[model samples]
Target: MRYLTDRKRAEGLGASKAGTEHHWYMNVSGVGLTLLIPFFVFILGTSLGAPYEEVVATLSQPFPAVIVGLTIAAGMLHFRRGAQMMIEDYWGGMTRKVMLWTVICLSYLVIAAGLYAIVRIAI
Candidate 1:
């Protein structure tokens, strides 16, 4: 017996089970980045070209530290999802799998490194 509704069947989930989820994630992340980028830019801009100690002091403050951390995490995760969509669209077979894995790893590495640097500064 068939369990799927017409809507579900029409969504064509057999080939890609996460189309809607991926789109939703991308949208959410886009909104998050929109909200975050201005604050992030302002913080970085204020620190730009300052002496090393001043830069450290600025970033060490809780608000700037938290903003930077959140921005890094959100941006990298958004990038990962977008890159996955691109690779899936353009590449095929093992190449697609390899590219996806590479993108995922790179995105996470960037997020980890950014957060680590923020923590180092804040502490």
Candidate 2:
């Protein structure tokens, strides 16, 4: 007795392929997030109980500033990709396209804001 019907087997798990570019993007983002998370946590942990000026001063260091900026940028990209994937999965038709564009715009805005803040603190 066959478990899957011939038509079901032919469909082949819908249009989404598991081992495609989507998987690659997720894998790369996962690795980047793993590295970025620790740096972000460290920054937050060290900044705790510190005054605003002190926090700014700490970030002003070239090394810390660069690390923080890179992490923030990577994080934004990761978030954008994940959200886009989810939107595509759950939404369809014009709504899906709108949501995708919205995610893209939001991600860009977040990255821009982060970069601006980092520059202000560092410089």
Candidate lDDT values, in order? 0.91, 0.83
Give the range of the ten consecutive residues with the poorest summed lDDT in model 2.
10-19
Best model per TM-score:
1
lDDT of 1 by residue, 12-75 (tens): 4657877766777899999989999999999999899999999999999999999999999999
TM-score of 1: 0.87
Candidate 2 stretches greater than 4 Å from native:
1-19
lDDT of 2 by residue, 18-120 (tens): 4356566788978988987787789868988899899999899887787788887888888888898889879999999999999999999989998999999
User: Any runs in candidate 1 off by more than 4 Å, and if so which?
Assistant: 1-14
Candidate 2 similarity to native, TM-score: 0.78
The true-versus-predicted C-alpha distance at residue 28 of model 2, in Å, is 1.7
